[model samples]
Target: MDREAKKEAFRKYLESSGVLDALTKVLVSLYEESDKPSAAVEFIKQKLGGPSLSEHEKLQAEKMDLQRKYDELLAAHRDACKELEELRNLKHEGDVKEMVDNNDAKEM
Candidate 1:
């Protein structure tokens, strides 16, 4: 039933007074074992219960963070490629020195 009735029934049952709580207790204890008994499955089921939008929100937040990181890394990689192309086209010592300086700045 509800909380108060269930509690009173449990206490009375522990007091060895009646037989109504027998089926309920047995059913609760054996709930997961009727057809598909699994401790892991029950644990996961319990974890997913109870107003649980947080798990979905957490996954979305993680996806956003990963997307942001991916965009940053992609931009850095493209810039690195462009700099590498410029360095390849360098024609003199001064040009090589400038490219090396720019590369060092990028590393910093």
Candidate 2:
């Protein structure tokens, strides 16, 4: 109901969910590192089993590549459908021409 009460409830939730313990362990590991990482936040995130910056970047690149490929494939599919429709129309026209020619020949 109050600000302090909300903070206490959230803190209890974190402790009960083991988030506080996990963070403590990760922090301890970072503190004990012989050579501290220049990117301390990234180091802590990685220690906490989150993706490091480079890995995140690599995944982003991969997703972009896949999206590009999907767009290309979609364009190709649309083109193929258009071509197929044109071919069907041509065949229909040819069939109609043949029928008309046959009727003219019968009249002659």
Evaluated with TM-score, which candidate comes out highest? 2
Error of model 2, residue 18, in angstroms: 2.4
Whole-model lDDT, candidate 2?
0.97
Q: What digit string (tens of lDDT, one per residue) describes model 2 on residues 1-108?
A: 999999999999999999999999999999999999999999998988899889999999999999999999999999999999999999999999999999999999
Candidate 1 Cα lDDT to native: 0.70
| Residue pairs of candidate 1 with colliding backbone atoms | none
Of candidate 2, the 10-residue stretch with the lowest lDDT total is 44-53
> What TM-score number comes out for model 1?
0.39
Estimate, for each residue in 45-68, the C-alpha lDDT of model 1 and write its tens digit: 444342234666888899999999
> Model 2: how far is 94 from its true place, Å?
1.2
Q: List the residue pairs that clash in candidate 2.
A: none
